[model samples]
Target: MEIAVVTGGVAEIERDAGQGSSMEAEWLALLAALRLARRQGLADFVLLGDAAAVVAQANGAVRAPGAMAAHLSAFFVLASDGPAPRVRHIKRTQNLAGIALARGR
Candidate 1:
């Protein structure tokens, strides 16, 4: 099975927004990685996030359980046979591309 690593990067705003969480951006970033892999016809892939929470969410960790949990669980089950992909976590320093994308630089 072909494996792809979907990685994300994170940065703190020196000038804090203080209200809206940047989680949406991170979420979009995860989607971006997933989309890229899909475009390449790669079904088996892993998602790596800067934070452990993101990784666990993608990998179906047992914390903060919700619809995402159920979705990921189901996705993994189906993908296991239908070109399964894996999701994991990586440090921000390790995700250079994602960092750049996040920074919009």
Candidate 2:
């Protein structure tokens, strides 16, 4: 699993294959991004990612699967008990930069 948190063009990334599933990783990454932003005193932020299921769950547009339900719940708690850092899903083609960064290429 690889996660990137970008703010002002500066990106902070974390990778953990130790985590079981991609959905879990996405949820964890989203939670970590929000926590990082809040700890850095960043407000009114936007979170972009390539995971549609995770985005929908985070945005309350759909229910999270059992594997990621708890992870999503945790994100909501950190996001002021609701959505924060507005999440948007992008096409994988449009996410080349993030993919390259994640691959360290």
Candidate 3:
């Protein structure tokens, strides 16, 4: 999975070994991004990605099912433990930088 943290319009890319579907990778990336932001002393952040389902789950629109349920639960706990976080979905073309990084993975 590839995660990009955009703080002040500048982005830093990070990657992890992705398992399962694209949505899973996106969810994992969201978790990782939030953790990274907290480590950087960020008190509030927004996560932008191209995965619709994952974004929906993060935004509490859809239920996280199967293996993702645990991750989703963990996401909420970690998020509330520190900074305020927002997750958003964007078009793949608009997320080209992350797309390239994910493809390389």
Candidate 4:
């Protein structure tokens, strides 16, 4: 899987998701993005993704599957360190990270 983080229409992070299912890759991407934001000391930011289920899980709108529970927990722990970033779902066409990954392909 290809994962990417885009800021200001530029790719800030991009790499291959070594080995995982699509769902796992999505969670990994989100975790990586949050880690980057925290490292950069970003206080206010929103994470946008095309994965609705993942977004819902992150926002507490729906329960994550058992397979993803650990990922959900890790996400919460990282988010709790500072201002929790909002995770929102957007259309695939509007997802910059997705677009970046597509372009790279």
Residues 1-101, model 3: lDDT tens digits: 55565555556676655546766767777887788788888876677878888888888999989988988898999888876688888998877547557
Score each candidate by Cα lDDT. Answer: 0.51, 0.75, 0.75, 0.87
Off-target runs (Cα >4 Å) in candidate 2 are: 81-83
lDDT digits (tens) for residues 16-84 of candidate 1: 223333443444455555656666676556756775665666665554345345445544544454454
TM of each candidate vs. truth? 0.54, 0.81, 0.77, 0.92
lDDT per residue as tens, model 2, 1-105: 776666666667776536567677777777877887788787677777788998999999999878788887788788884445698999876664366565684
Worst 10 residues of 4 by lDDT: 7-16
Best-first order by TM-score: 4, 2, 3, 1
16, model 3: CA deviation in Å? 5.3
Candidate 3, residue 86: Cα displacement in angstroms equals 0.9
The deviation in Å at residue 57 for candidate 4 is 0.2
In candidate 3, list every pair of residues with a backbone clash.
none
When sorted by lDDT, best at the front, the candidate numbers are: 4, 3, 2, 1
lDDT of 4 at 100: 80
